[model samples]
Target: MSSQAAAIAPSELLEAARVSKAWPFEEARKIVSRLEKEGGVSRTVLFETGYGPSGLPHIGTFGEVARTTMVRRAFELLMPGVETRLICFSDDMDGMRKIPDNVPDRAFLEPYLHMPLTRVPDPFTNEYPSFGDHNNAMLRRFLDTFGFEYEFASATEYYKSGRFDPILRRVAERYDDIMAIMLPTLGPERRATYSPFLPISPKTGRVLYVPMKKVNAADATITFDDEDGEETTLPVTGGHVKLQWKPDFGARWAALGVDFEMFGKDHGPNMGVYDRICAALGGRPPEHFVYELFLDEKGEKISKSKGNGLTIDEWLAYAPSESLALYMFLRPRQAKKLYFDVIPRAVDEYYQHLAAYPRQDVKERLGNPVWHIHGGNPPAIVLPVSFALLLNLVSASHAHDKAVLWGFILRHVPGVTPQTHPELDRLAGYAIRYFEDFVKPAKVFRAPDEVEAEALQALSVKLGTLPAGADGETIQNALLDVARGIERYQDHAKTSPEGGPGVSVAFFQMIYQVLLGQERGPRFGSFAALYGIDNTRELIARALAGGDLSEV
Candidate 1:
């Protein structure tokens, strides 16, 4: 362990966590306080997050697991020795009611509508045996990418293997009570057909949605009319029957003795129904947390069936998993856009938090997103340069490959190689991908107007006055000094609606537009610092001479 990490005392972490205002700490404290108030801690605390598996797992799905893991970490700190388990439960048995528009090439799923997901054929790969198996594997694969410690559970396996038989029977026993709580939440048509138990049809191999004609709690059998109008009686246990979505939610909680579970904001309205069902089944309802929804480009809530917004793989393609975690950690209860544009800021902010972690005291560190992201042990190290700076380097160099970026990086920071600076290497690759997708397509380098061209010439002269290896701050201040000397910028500094720094800001904006083809960017000096002071002068020379700024 690094000295910085070793210096963080466990006792200090515990004390800080007790008083920390961090959301995860607050959430974890809720669990600790609840357990204490309910007499004493006895059994293992179970943390659960559910996935429908009706569509491929998206980044929003990743958020729940990641956030819950953060809370679990905080809880461990407060309780010290209490046992905890995080179960990433997949509702793979849910009927393929609607095919997702975004999963790609799902025309084969139409004929299998209403069949359990596990019963449908795997459309993409033969290795998974069934569509449900395929999706469950996808969820597991994404979770595994982050090294999340979770027990994977499937609704189909749990139902078929009799692990849920006990709860299934209890659900049957309290069928009326569960129904009483659920019926009021449905529309008249849905209420007339709804049953807590849905019998899996032996003939059609689909979970039937018809009304239960006879419910015998004594035998745990539910009699329902099939599509053919034939009366069928099936035992609720042994996979012959499954509960409807809401009842299944409640019974799953009871069955697992879940101590804490989280669901989307959409389900916040149905919280009472789930809890009542759990109580009717003679089990205590676990604590529930409702987090906000993720939005697509139009500010519409992202839906699984609609398949909107970025997928887990899409986010990973352009940013590190740590950055993604940081995005999920910040203000989770408030809705935020989950699109390509958010990646750059998330990446830079994560680096900022990681860079700050070592210097922050216990309470301040507890509030840092990276601390929660890394479970209170954020890496004491960071990439040599910020992600924003790397993006600028990629753009200014117009390098098509990571090798080219590495060449530049090695020149600026000596002795760094793919082996010695792996983080820098990975960041370079991500920056290149981001640049190609988002930056390259949108780039439109504008020629500097007369006054701006003169400023650029002046800026280049000012930079040359500095030593070859001047620090980023010195280089930045010198560049600003040149801008302050420009007549147009000085006039704008007093009259600009944005205020005095508008002079420096406008000057920097002109530099970025002329050279990098972006509206805004990292401080020119920082980019120069990482790209090297001499290299920056060359870039300015290219800009002034109207040469191709993209080429080496």
Candidate 2:
């Protein structure tokens, strides 16, 4: 039997870029092939640039991880047997410069200055423990929710596992040479006793300086000077071990055998430094991609110091996780500013596009016509704006009445079968969620506090009844009719600006304003056809029953 016989309707090409011959798809394919051919380096391990002092993970943080995951998926598709490892590093050992607004007492965190990040106070408070613990925990929760795997914290693992010793010895072996390279930027007067690594000292404000001469790769031990200038030896206990901003990157290459990493353009200089150190350490600099920053709703750059940013929790409330994931994936993981407004449209578009992409893998195994039509080429589908408007219209219907509405949809859109989709389930969830979170039930028109008396008076005069027969399906359908007409009138007016007063349009829109208190909304005709005119009419009556629309 042919697969096409059993296949659903086809979707469309994702976009111009997705189908463009110029995309780096071939290069990506080559990298995976080469990595697989080499054998020792696990095709799985993809290094991620860590987030340290940045409180509350931002969408950009997720962007880095998601993009890596996409590339990882591509590898798995092309090279079967390959596993994926997304190494999430929290650079908590870095210095802390400012206290966020939420912290109760800034003075308490002051003692930890200049030391590595692990020494800082727990931002989530004592119950959760350390500052590093709180921030890392939040990040882990967000990523785990998004389905990322293989998380490792830089604060607690490296030293205990003897990961830093080889780098320390290499730094000591070329102490004079490495210092010479750092001299111009770090200044000639900078102390030459420093090894590239600087681990956090939980008991002291300054970083614990492990002596280069005492670092033992085999034993995982190092000696450093106490405040009194006397040398003391200690075992490496925490992963909060130091990484030289750029040079130790080479050490990372040597120590962890990282295959890939992504960073921002601002770190271009640091990347160069790491490459130099990588050469000095006889390790190849990890392959990398540079991505940009994410901005907020107002077009301002999100900054921790400026006290401007949105966290994952706030976004999840309004945006679907998959939509958010696609928003991050649509962009090239290079230096660019991702604006927030791009989200709503991105969400709509990605859902539509997924319907277009190949859902099953068949081109590799099967050489048949069914494969050609069903699995080879992408599927064509509706535009995003249209989809969102349609969804909004669908949501306008009562959740309890979707089956009948689906019948109406199937009538107009022939090929689109209304299967019990997980996405539709999610959208339904979103509708209820959005209404609860942002919708004010008594809102009159667009204003939150419009007078209820005025609404009641408006309804009384228009319908000639205090309230409609019932507050059930009948009233809702009547309200939906008004909302739908208003939208049509506005759309028509905008399309044909010169067109005069649309009485029918005005009447419908005014009715919705009188009842639901919105200027424009879901289609009344299609909605009536879907939910049935009786149900729609009842909802409006219930809303306006004896109540003055003018007062509402």
Candidate 3:
């Protein structure tokens, strides 16, 4: 039987992983092919993603790591026996430069300006030793929650332990070449004082940006003038000196033997410069990709300094992490807005993919988001309804308790209790939270127009005449007939706007507005049947009588 199934399988089954068409899988295949040509899979492939610990980790940070890990997973699937390492490298040794406005206790960080982030005191007072340590811990906590397998590297440790010493020496030996690649990009004022090595002041413990007076490459030492015009010499190897951003990036790539890395498109100009620097130092740059930046709701770039987008915590609170993963998986190169408004649709899409996964063959299932979401082991379960439908139910029923929402859910999907549907139960909670935070507050009830009111009145009377246990199909037909009747009435009355398709659409909009306090919602007939025809008729009657519809 297994052989027979394989014989009739789709052509994609004969391909690599059945998902080679995806961007991540294609990139992974390219990397594997390159590695095979170079030295074979005996050597380990390194995938590196960089993070600047200048502020607390946000959703964008999660996006980079999650997307990189997806590619890493794809690489593993393509080369099952090969060794791969995904490194989450943190540049924590960077100078504080300026305190971010989004961080807590800004006044405390004021005195530590120009100091290494790892040396600055923790403003949140979590006793993590330094601000950088606290932020790094937060990054680790969320990554762990997402079950990411990665090795974390700190710049301070790499520098202080002399692990970067060889790269530092290389940068020193190729100082003139690196300077030539960098100086042309800067203005004359900055070029006059620019140096590849930024020495930390031994006296004040501040990152000094002074010009290098002399460099003894043979001894790995750089001499620079201090703040008081006194000359100071320091070994360029240890933590005593750090390379500037461009040189540092290239040196790190060479030292780590990185095979793949990506950054935002805003850094496009620096890509060639870094590649050139690496080439001049006799090292090749990694396979690179440039992804677009995430934007805010207003189509403005989401900036950490501006504090204008949803944080990771905020996203997780209102939706599952899988929803965010799906969001990251879709068209990463295009600029998409990240805000609370996108959460509901993403949640629904995640469920849609999961619900469709089981019915698909190997080829179609491989292309499903659930396959990537679960790392090729999608679970066996079905969501009864969409998160949007649940939110609408919660809003219409005023379900303040999970049991109350589950009561309606069990009605839709019979025999699937809270125990059998734990995932749905959790989603119900997310729906309630999302409704409270984003939906309820924005709701504005609009009274139906005169024609819409008469149509709704007739629909309510027809609903009242329905049998107590009418089926969904019957209720749906009744609703459609009511819409048709309204069109006929408009034709007889000779009303403007023709009472054509727009009349039914307007009547449904009025129902959603008066009943659910929105412009759109679940299919009205199904909603009416599931919510109980008697209760829906009561709500409609309340709307017709000009009474308060809020209680419904």
Candidate 4:
């Protein structure tokens, strides 16, 4: 490999992107080879993807942004000294739909159903803030929290400065071509205004003076003459630098100098139009690849318009951002369905991948090629938590520390761990942050109810008494011993796979019920073994003493 060819994640995405599937294989290969040889290192590449401001940004919206960030990092790492920029364009120029549930309601939104996004109210404060401003702020905050570097807002300043006028005009001039591309893929009603490139005023029968080669930002105002012949000019303030749905996106891509972007599969036909448009417009269409949509637990596509979705904040409450990134990255973007039911597997699989990553020197010297799977580069530690979790446990003074209770996890879940698993840390961090940011009252942490209480009490008695003042180390070992005893019985049943003279699953579960004071606790052996026997016992004893040992 050339020194300039930096090692990236074990992914074929970039290589795949380079080879246009829409073109002939020979031509695609030739293009890919040329880029690899001549374009030895990418210089100042810009990756642009737009997010709409019509609703609370869903996980899918963030998924596109996260994917872009990963691609940018790969380029930076591979082509040392290369500059990569990821710009998230908020589509605030698009009209708003009905208000989202959690969005703030500004009275100003009612009159502007067909108007631009800049006219809508702030969704968060319900104050008279521009919709674009509100959505841009939210996305910026979300990305910033995840350490994303982005030149934000595609609508506001770009529209305000009229930078997109030429692009809009090109769209307008190619109105017939753009409509041809969009209409074939759209429904009858949608085909009417679907070509966002057209500058015809709905208020009057006049064409807006959109520039042909540059963005339209001059004082080209639209005047509306009402039914009674009353004339009014609403300044035609901020029209989005929007492409006419399909092919004009190709125009916008060239005009805006975008190198790469990812969109959902729902727009597959739209991308087809873009490819043809790219060839026609004398612009290299930014790589417009399709990534699959994420579905909720119910197997339905997550939708912001339907008022049914989980925001990044909600996901952060459960897992780290890094975990979320890994989850997003693990699958080929082309795969159809990415449901939330597999999140637990995503978490476990991520850690497993980390554990299996080439760590031993003997394996390295042997030239074990497992690491070369993703274009001869190991995957980026996209999930920071994976690194943190591995390191925290690997470097802990005692195994007991590894098994800290949920209460202690936030404070003691090593800073490095959270940093590594940004997604997981986001979840853990949110509980702490939500209270601080929202000024919500401290929710009293309570223990499990009576049935759980009795189960825990019985387990404690079975584990036997530890001498007073027993150090954390000793207590952890004893706990492990009990866990081992339970696991030993479990082993016998597993091998037999039928009735055996060993402890049954029900009986083993009972042992856990007694030990941790819950119907289920962390894996008994692993938990105690990692935390150390003494620490495990003490933590349990403390919980027992508190009379509030909750079922996690």
Q: Which one is best on lDDT?
A: 1
- Candidate 4, residue 62: how far the Cα is off, in Å: 2.7
- The model with the greatest TM-score is 1
Per-residue alpha-carbon lDDT of candidate 4 for residues 1-552, written as tens digits (9 for 90 to 100): 112123333234444334323212222234234347655645567788878777767777887887666555544433446576778877666555455555445464566564566665565575546766766777788888877778885665675577766655555455556556556777776654353443334463223333232222344433434334554443333442334345546766767777778788777756767876765556676665577777665667877765455677766764556557666664535453444334444555655554455453422311222222232244434332332232222222212223232323433334445445554444434333332332123123335345444544544654457554444355444443443344333445343323433444554355344433324333454444444445555555655566433322
Question: Model 2: per-residue lDDT, tens digit, 66-126?
Answer: 7666555444444556665668877666667566666667788777666555667675568
User: Candidate 1: which stretches are off by over 4 Å?
Assistant: 1-3, 414-419, 491-504, 548-552
Give the alpha carbon lDDT tens digit for every residue of 216-269 in model 1: 889988888887888888888889888888898888888888888878899999
Residue-level lDDT of model 3, residues 11-63, one tens digit each, is 45436463557777777777877787787678888999988888888788888
Which stretches in model 2 have alpha-carbon errors above 4 Å? 1-27, 33-49, 82-84, 184-195, 199-205, 208-241, 304-307, 333-343, 358-423, 436-552
Model 3's number of clashes is: 0
How high is the CA lDDT of each candidate model?
Answer: 0.85, 0.53, 0.81, 0.51
Residue pairs with clashing backbones, model 3: none
Cα deviation of 412 in candidate 3 (Å)?
A: 4.5
User: For every model in order, what is the number of clashing pairs?
Assistant: 0, 56, 0, 46
Compared to the true structure, candidate 2 yields what TM-score? 0.65
> Could you tell me the C-alpha RMSD of candidate 2 in Å?
8.7
Could you tell me how far off, in angstroms, the CA of residue 262 lies in candidate 2 after the best superposition? 1.2
